[model samples]
Target chain A: MNALLTSAVAGLTAAGAYALLGVCAVFTFRLVAVVNFTGAAIGTAGTFSMIGFISLGVPLWPAVVLGILVGTLAGALIGLVMTQWFSEATATTKAAVTAALLVGIVALGLRLTGGQSPKEFPTLFPGSAFRLAGVEVTVASVLTVVLALVFTLLADAFLNRTRTGLHLRALSERPMAAELLGVRVRILALLVWAVTGAFTTFALMIIAPQRSPDFMSLSLLVVPALAAALVGAFRSFPLALAGGLTIGIVEGMSSAIDGISQYRGILPFFVILAVLLWSQRGARWDEAR
Target chain B: MTRTLDVSGLVINRAGLPVVRGVSLSAQKGQISVLLGANGAGKTTLLEGLSGIIPTSGGDIALNGRSVIAARAGERARAGLSHVEQGRTVFRQLSTEENLLVGMAPGADLADAYDLFPELLNRRGVRAGLLSGGEQQMLVIARSLLTRPEVILIDEMSAGLAPVVVQRLMAAVRRLADAGLAILLVEQFAALALRIADHAYVMRRGELVYDGLPQPLLADPDRLHHLYLGDVQAA
Candidate 1:
C-alpha cells in the first residue's frame, strides 16, 4: 500500500508538468485554430540555452530567464510567419505549416545541442522529502502541484472574466465574424503565441530534471501532451489539465502490472486513437472546424 | 437628401474576370435601397468589395462624405459601416449577450440592444448556435445595431425562414430605417423587398439593368421576370 501511495505521489508530480504543456497546446489551438506541434522543441531549445549560459558561468536564475525569453521569441516568430504569410490559408494548411515548423525546430535544436545524449539537469528546488500519510514526497513535487493549480485558476479567470478574454473567445468561435466585428485578431494571435512559448519553457524547466534531459526525448514529450489536449477537444483548459493528470496516473499504475509493463510508451497512442474514433463516429469528413 | 453611403464606378475582379462592373449607387439616411438579383448576379460580391472583404480594382466608397476606399474591413467597421453577412454568421460558441458585447463600440450600452430586440433579452445567456434560425437572425442584426452604425449592408436577411418570422424581421428593419439608419438590402425575393424599398436596382450578369423607383418595377411584371429568369414570356 505504501508502494502504491509512493507511485501516486510521483505520478501527480509528473502530471503537473504534463498538465502545463496540455494547457498551452489547448490555449494556442483555441485562439489560432492550429495545433502547435513545435512547443516541445521550443522548450528543449530553451533548456539547452539555459544550460549553455550556466556553462559560461552565468547565474542560474538569470540564465533561466534568458532561456524563457528565447522560447517566447521563437513562439512570436511562428506567429509572425502565420499571420504575415499564411493568414489567408485554410485550417489544414495552417496546421501543415505548424508541422513543418516542428520539424525545422527539432532539427535546429539537435544541431545546437551537438548530440542526442542525455545530460544532467540541475534542479532549483531544495532536495528535501517529507513523510505524508506514511508516503515520502519531495518539496519539488509539492511545488509543482501547487504551481500548476495556481496557473490553471489564473488562466481560467483571464479567459472568462476579462474583456480581452471575451474577444479571444469570440475569435475562437468564428474568426471572420470576429474580424468583421472589429477585433484585432492578428495582434491577439501574436500574444497567444508568446504566452504559449513562455509556458512551454516553464513546464520543461520543472519537469526535465525528473528524467535524463535530451533533445529527442524532451521534444517527444509533446505526444502525450497532445493526447491530453485532444481529450479536451482543444477547447477546455480545465478538462485538458484533468486529462493530463489522468494519463500520468494511469501510466504510473500500469507499470506495476507485469503483463503491460513493456507497453507503457504506447498508452498515449491508444488514448488518442480511441478519442479520434469516438469523436468522428457518424460525423461527416467535410465538417472539419 | 444627405447620402450616408455613396459608391461610384465600383469595379471588382475575381481571378482577372470582372464580377461587378462599374456599379454606381447611393443610399440616403432613413431609407432602404434594395438590390434585387438572382444567384450569381454579383450582388454579394459588390457588397463584399464595398466592405473591403475583397479587393476592388477601381472604385470610390464614401461613408458620410468621407472616402473609405483605403480602409480594411475592420477599419470600415470602426468607421460606422456595419455588414450583416449572408447566412447570419453569428459566433456560435458565444452567448447572445457575448455576441452583442463583441459588436458594441466603446462606451456603448447594451440596454439599447435589449430594448430593440426583447426576444434576445430573454435568451441572452444561451449559445447563439442553439437559437432558432429567426432568433439567430435577430441576434446578428441586434449585435450590429450595438455598433451604432451610420450605414448597414445586409445580405439575404430572410433566407430559410418562415414568412411570419421574415415579416417580423422586415418590420424591425423598417423601424431601423425610420430611426435614420441608411440601409442597403440585398434580397432574392423581389416582391418582398419591393414592399419596403424606396429605391431599387436590378442586376443581370454583373451589370445593373434597371435603376429607378420600386413602383415601376413592381407594376411591370414582365420586366422583373426578364431580369430574374431571363424569359419575358414567363411573366
Candidate 2:
C-alpha cells in the first residue's frame, strides 16, 4: 500500500510536467489548426541548450532563462510559418509540416549532443531526498508539481477571464466571422504562437534533469500530454490537468511491478486513441466551444 | 467640402461577370438616398463594390473626392464609409459590446452610439448569434452608428424583419440623417424604403433604370407594378 501511495505521488509530479506540455500543444494546435509533431523536440533542444550553457561556465539561473527564451522564440517561428505560409495549406499539408518539423528537431538534437549517448541534465534543485509523512520525494519533483498547478490555474484563468483570451478562442472557432468583426486574426494567431513557445521552453527547462536530451524520448512526450488535452476536449484546462495527473499516476504505478517500465509509456497513447475514436463517433471536434 | 459619395460609371464583377454595370449614383450630405430593386437586381452588389469588399471591375468610387478603388475593407471603414451589410451580418462569437467597440472609427463619439441604442448597453455581454433576428439587426446598426461616419451605407435593413422592428430601425435611420449624416440604403421593400427616403433610384440587371423623388415611384402603381408587382398581380 505504501509502495502504491509513493507511485501515485510520483505520478502526480510527472503528470504536472505532462500538463504543461499539453497546454502548449493545445495552444499551438488551436491557433493555426495544426498539431505540432515537433513540440517535444523543440523542448529537448531547450534542455540541451541549458546543459551546454551551464557547461560553458554560465550560472545555472541565467542558462535556464536563456534556454527558455530561445526555445520559445523558436516555437513562435512555427506559428509564424503556419500563419503566413501554411495559412492556405490543406490539413494534409499541415500534418506534413508538423512531421517534417519533428524530423528536423530530432536531427537538430543529434547535432547538438554531438551524437553522444543519453546524459544526465543539470537541475535548479539540489538532488536530495525529502520526507513528507514518510513519502520520499525529490526537491525538483516537488517544484515541478507545484509549478504545474500554478501554470494550469493561470492558463485556465487567462482563457476564460481575459479579453484577448476570449478573442483567441473566438478566432480559432470562426476566423472569418472574427475578421469581419474587425479582429486582426493574423496578429492573434501569431500571439498564440509566441506565448506557446514560451510555455514549451519553460516546461522543458524545468524538467530537464530527469532525462537525457534525446529526440525520440522528447518527441514521445506528446503521447502523455496529448492524452490530457484529449480529455479536456482541447477546451477545458481543468480536465486537461486532471487527465495529466491520472496518466502520470498510472504510468508511475506500472513501474512498481517488474518488467512493466518497458511498456508503461504506451498507456497514454492508448488512452488518446480511445478518446479520439470515441469523439469521432460522437460529435464533430471543430465546432468550437 | 460637404460629405458626398460619388460612384461614377462604376462596374462590378462577381465571378468574372459584370453584376453592376456603369452604375453612377450619389448621396449628398444629410439626405436619405434609397436604392429600390428586386432580387438579383445588383443592388447588393453595388453596395459591396462601393464598400470595397469586392473589387470594382471598372469606373471610380470617390468619397469627398478621394478615390478608393484599391483600399481594403477595413481601410475603407476607417475612412468613414460604414457599411451595415445585407443579411445583418453580425459576428456570432463576439459580445454585443465588443462588436460596438470594433465598429467605432479609431476614435469617435461612442456616447452617441449608447444614446442612440440604449438597449445595447443591457445586452452588451451577450454574443450576437443568440440574439433574436430583430435584436441582431439592431446590434449591427447600432455598431455602425458608433463610427459616426459622414456617410452610412445600410443594405436591406428591413429585410426579413417584423413590421414593428422595421419601424424602429427606420426611426433610427431618420435620427441619424437628422443629425446631418448622409445615408445610402438599399432596400427591396419599396413602400418602406420610399417612406424614409428623400430620393430613390431603381436598378434592373446591374444598371440604374430610374432616378427621382420617392413620391413619384410610390404613386405610380403602373410603374411600381411593372417594377416589382407583376408576379403578385399575375399569380
Candidate 3:
C-alpha cells in the first residue's frame, strides 16, 4: 500500500508535465481553434535537436534554447499553413488537418531522430529532494506544479486584460468581424502557436530526463495531454490542468500494481473514451453534444 | 476636400455565379445613400464587396480619391472604412466597453459612442451577448462609429427590431450623416430608410434598377413595388 502511495507521490513530476501540456492544448483550441495533435511531436523536434546539439559537444543551456526555437518555428509553420489555407475551415476540418499533420510529424521525427536507439537524458534537477509528509519529494515535481499554476494565471490575465490579448480573444470568437475591426488575425494566431510551442518543449524538457524514452513514445505524449484537455471540454484551463494531474497520479498508482503496469500507457485512451461517453449520455445521435 | 466612398463597375461572384454585376455607386459626405432591394436582390453582397468582407471579382473601390479595391477587409478598415456587418456582429463574449475599444485607435476617446447611445454607459461591463436586441444594435453601430470612419457601410440596420427601436436607430444614423460622415445604409424598412436618405439606389437581378432621389421612390410606391416584384415574377 505504501509502495503504491510512494509511486503516486513520485508521479507528481509527470503530473506537472501532463498539466502543462494539457494547458497548452486547451489554449490553442480556444485561441486558434485547432485540437493540435502535433503538439508533443513539435516539441520532440526541438527535444531531438537539443539532444543532437548536446552530442555535438554544444553546451547544455544553448542547445536547449536552440531546441525550443526549433519547436516554436515548427508551431508557427503549422499556424501559417492553417491561416493561409484553412482560415475559414470548420472546427472538425481544422482538427482533421492537425491529426494528419501529427502523423506526418511523427514519421519525420522518427526518421530524423535516432529511431530504435537509446539516448542519455540528463536530469535538470538531479538528486534534489525534500521530506514531505514522510516521503521524499523531488524539487522537479514542485517546480512543474508551480510552473503550471503560474503560467495558467499569467495566460488568463493576458487574454482578459491586455489590449492585444483582447484582440486575440475577439479574433478567436469572431474572425470575420474582428478583421473588419482592424485586428491582425494571422499575427496573433502565429503568436499563440509559438508561445504554446515554447511551453510544450519546456515541459517535456523537465520530465524527459526521468525516463529516457524513445522518440516515438516521447512524441505520443500528446495523447495524455489531449485527454486532459478533453476533461475541460478544451475551454476551461484549470479543469484541464487538474485532469492532467489526476491522470498522471492514476497511471503512477497503476504502474505499482502487477497486472496493469505494462498497459499503463493506454490509460489516457480510456479517459478520453469515458469523457466522450459521459458527455453524450442523454443526447440522440443527431443532437449529440 | 470631402472624401467620398465610391465603387465603379463592381462585379462579385459567389459559388461560380455573379451575385452583383456592373454596379456603380457612391456615398457623398454629409449625405445618406440608401441601397434598397428585396430579399434576393444582392444588396448584401454589394455591401460586402464594398467592405471587402468577400472578394470582388472586378471593379475599383475608391476612398479619398485613391483606389482601395486591392485592400483587404482589415486594410480597408484601417484606411477609414468601417462596416457594421449584418445581424449585429458585436463580439458576444466581450464587454460593451471592450467591444467599443476594439474599434478605438490609440489615444482616442471612447465618449463619442456613449454620447450617441447613453444606454451603453451603464451596460459597459456587461457582456454584449447578454444585451437586448435594441442594445446589441446600438453596440454594433457604436463599435463601428468608434473607428472614426470617413465612410460607414451599414447592412440591414432595421433587421429584426421593433418599430420604436428602428426609429431610434434611424435617428442616430441621421445624426451621423449630419456630422459629415459618409453613410451607406441597407435597410428592409424602405419607407423609414427613405425618410432621411438624400439619395436612394434600388437593386434588381444583380443590377441597379433605380438610382435617384429618395423623394421620387417614396412618392411612387407602385414603381418601387414593380421593381421589387420584377424578381418575384421571374422566379
Q: Compare the candidates by DockQ and give the number of the best one.
A: 3
Candidate 2 local lDDT, residue B186: 88
Q: Write the per-residue lDDT of candidate 3 for residues B27-133, one digit (tens) a residue.
A: 99999999998898899999899988889999899998899999989899988898998899888999999999976876557898999999999999999999999
Q: Judged by lDDT against the true structure, how good is candidate 2? A: 0.75
lDDT of 1 at B124: 96
Q: Model 2 over residues B199-226: C-alpha lDDT tens digits?
A: 8888878888777888977787568656
TM, chain A, every candidate: 0.91, 0.87, 0.95
DockQ metric for all predictions: 0.60, 0.23, 0.77
Q: How many clashes (backbone atoms < 3 Å, residues ≥3 apart in a chain or on different chains) does model 1 have?
A: 0
Candidate achieving the largest lDDT: 3
Which window of ten consecutive residues has the lowest lDDT sum in model 2 chain B? Answer: B226-235
What's model 2's lDDT at B216? 79
If ranked by lDDT, best first, what sequence of candidates would result?
3, 1, 2
Better of 2 and 3 by TM-score: 3
How do all models score by TM-score? 0.90, 0.78, 0.95
Report the candidate with higher lDDT, 1 versus 3: 3
Interface RMSD of 3: 0.8
> iRMS for all predictions?
1.0, 3.5, 0.8
